[model samples]
Target: MNLNLRHAVISNVSGNNQGQLQDTIVDAIQSGEEKMLPGLGVLFEVIWQNADDQDKQEMLATLEQGLKK
Candidate 1:
């Protein structure tokens, strides 16, 4: 059985509002379970695909700062 994780993840969260999305992200991070990583990556991919250049630059800068910590 071939599964497309990105599609599945997007479908699962398709109708979520900003608050629900925030809860999902915060819950995943707080859980710190390896299994949640794929879902988080899929969410990040969705954000990256839709982000403009400035948003992407801000995200990259935030990530760079995070890596230093």
Candidate 2:
């Protein structure tokens, strides 16, 4: 079977409003389930791809700071 998880994740969240998207992210993180990682990664990929250079740099800096803790 051929499966495209990233595509599936994006499609599942398509058309969601900002509040809905935030709820999805919050729920996934709060659940602490390993299975949610792939969905988060896919969402991150979408954000990274759409972010500008400054936003990407800020995101990287924030990620670095988080990793240090």
Candidate 3:
């Protein structure tokens, strides 16, 4: 997808209702929806991009630990 389209989807996910966003992402992963995975990655990128340094560090640490599972 183009950068603009990815950014738009990330914005939409960020603005969505909290629980719904989490459910949508988790469901997408669980169902192996290839297209949806990019959206989720964009959401994570957006969060990482916007987060304060300390928060970003914490998030990255959490992400790394999750990946080990």
Q: Estimate each model's TM-score.
A: 0.92, 0.93, 0.71
Model 2 segments more than 4 A misplaced: 1-3
Model 2 over residues 1-69: C-alpha lDDT tens digits?
125997799899999999999999999999999999889988998999999999999999999999999
Please give the ranking of all candidate structures by lDDT, highest first, separated by commas: 2, 1, 3
Per-residue alpha-carbon lDDT of model 3 for 1-53, expressed as tens digits? 57997877866766678898889778888989677777777877778788999
Per-residue lDDT of candidate 1, residues 1-69 (tens digit) = 125887888898999999999999999999999989999998998899999999999999999999999
List candidate 1 stretches off by more than 4 Å: 1-3
**Local distance difference test scores for all models:** 0.91, 0.93, 0.80
Candidate 1 local Cα displacement, residue 45, angstroms: 0.4
| Candidate number that wins on TM-score, 1 or 3 | 1
